[model samples]
Target: MKPVSRRTLDWIYSVLLLAVVLLSWGYVIYASTVAAQRQLRKEYPDKIFG
Candidate 1:
């Protein structure tokens, strides 16, 4: 089998790095949304889906 080229390796690394960064941002957004929902529920016990 032929060895992998440097350029191909760089591209793969770049794609992986981008995926990690995107996932991190998504997690942060999800956590913030959950926290906000919890806070709303505490503040408005009678309201539904606010």
Candidate 2:
């Protein structure tokens, strides 16, 4: 068995961090779009479909 090097660990950590950040941003954008749609529907139900 061999221990992992510092550079490899840092690379892994950075990749994981970037993935988390990207996922978070994706979810935020999706949620905002859904909220906006809901608001528009609530405010103008007829106008939305037409």
Candidate 3:
């Protein structure tokens, strides 16, 4: 059996970390936007803007 190269491993690790961070940030942003919208709706009743 052959051992994996360090450079390749490093690249894969970096890509995986980047994907995780991006997904987490995307979720956070989505949640924040939803919360903001909800707050706005609560603060302003009878307003059709969202």
Candidate 4:
């Protein structure tokens, strides 16, 4: 079989790596938002729900 092309492999690797990094960052951002919301709820319990 012919050897894999470096350009193609590089592109694939970069895309997958970028996807992973973006997903990780997304999770971090979502978690922080959730934590902030919880904190706000605690701090303004009546104003928010009343």
Q: Estimate the TM-score of every prediction.
A: 0.91, 0.90, 0.86, 0.81
lDDT string for model 1 (1-50, tens) is 89999999999999999999999999999999999999999999899864
What global local distance difference test value does model 2 have?
0.92
The candidate maximizing lDDT is: 1
Candidate whose TM-score is highest: 1
Off by over 4 Å in 4: 1-3
- Tens digit of per-residue lDDT, candidate 3, span 1-50: 79999999999999999999999999999999999888888999778764
Q: Rank the candidates by TM-score, best first.
A: 1, 2, 3, 4
Better of 1 and 2 by TM-score: 1
Output the better candidate (1/3) by TM-score: 1
Q: lDDT per model, in order?
A: 0.95, 0.92, 0.93, 0.92
Query: Ten residues in a row with the worst lDDT in model 3?
Result: 41-50
| Total residue pair clashes for candidate 2 | 0
TM-score of 1: 0.91
